[model samples]
Target: MSRKRGKSGRRAAPRRSQASTRRSPVGANAAPAGRAANRSRILLMIVGAAVLLTGAVAYRVFAGTSPATSSSATLLASTAGQAQGETVDGISCQTSEQVVYHIHAELMVFVAGESRVIPEGIGIVGCFYWLHSHTRDGIIHIESPVDRIYSLGNYFDIWKQPLSTTQVGPATGAVNAYVNGVRFSGDPRSIPLTPHAIIQLNVSSEVPAHTFTFPPGL
Candidate 1:
């Protein structure tokens, strides 16, 4: 009983100090309202920055285009008719044992039942033949005959890079076909073309079909 009585009065000392307490470091002297608000805003800014960075990294990983894998043009439809109108009248394809040919001479005439031509001296690789006097109208041609497997070489001054295929067979029947490092925009449709294949006259031109030449001995 005597110890209990002494403990109560000692605790009473804290009550007296509370009755006359002074300002303290974490109380009245604590950070101002403006300073506290600034701290909160800085924390929010840091969180937002982290979220934005994460989104950017995810986009790069999933949506980026690789030079070798990405194609500049779209996949053309199955046949050349899309170039003209509603029928096979506008486009045509001719195949030789060794080469595939497309002639864009005149689509209107083709629609009217006409054909385009192929030129000669075209089998040699790196040969440049100007089909039209107009450069824009000229046919950009390329060919490759394999003395060995997997040896492809192209020299088109138009494109600064050599981005095409040099395969023997048709390109797995896929659109946007490539052969011998040559890129062609057509339906996977091609000639009955094969290795060392030769044709008498095959001159392909994008000029109007009536005007395209089918020069002899292609």
Candidate 2:
């Protein structure tokens, strides 16, 4: 009877050891499963971010608007049109932009109390024009080979738009011009494109002239 009991006890010990071995595999597989789930969650997050970015780009493209100066501001298109390589008001379009006399000026236009975006690539169409805009922030870039005076009229010509006391682009009203925070008495088009000059035009309503701080290395 003692021998039989001892044998039964050994058999029971092996059964417990086998059970522990089986449980060890389950514990090891649980960690791998958790790591796999974490990886899947990370992948899902990355996909969600990509979708959001794509949606934003699509919205901007289809809406025909951008994050510009004002929410209600309409972004004006390049009026360079068919006059890309042609000279307008003595402003030349060359193969490359000249920096011999490079300066920047700011132009602000408001019609019915809403701002207007002077878009980039105004004087760019397969070439670079002397008087051009590189951004929609209203900075007009005067890059020419000669250091001479250029007027707002020349830029309007390049833009293929009209500017007068009664007209600014397609909007027509009693237009007011300001330069460097001072009221301009003469033709708004005659306002010279001076270095860091702040030129503002208002139609139908007048607002106080504002100054602009040019960016460094502008």
TM-score for each predicted model, relative to the true structure: 0.23, 0.67
lDDT of 1 at 133: 13
Error of 2 at 183 (Å): 0.1
lDDT of 2 by residue, 117-190 (tens): 88888888889989988777788999999999899998888888888999988889999998888889979988
The alpha-carbon deviation from the true structure for residue 80 of candidate 2, after best TM-score superposition, in angstroms, is 6.3
156 Cα displacement, candidate 1 (Å): 27
Indicate the TM-score of model 2: 0.67
Clashes of 1: 19
Task: Tell me the lDDT of model 2 at 39.
Answer: 100
Candidate 1 lDDT by residue in tens digits, 1-218: 33333555653332457536666756664568668899999999999999999989964543232111122322211222111211121112223222333222210101111121212222222322221111121232322222222111211112211223222121121113333334434322232233322211111222221122222332
Predicted structure with the largest TM-score when compared to the true one: 2
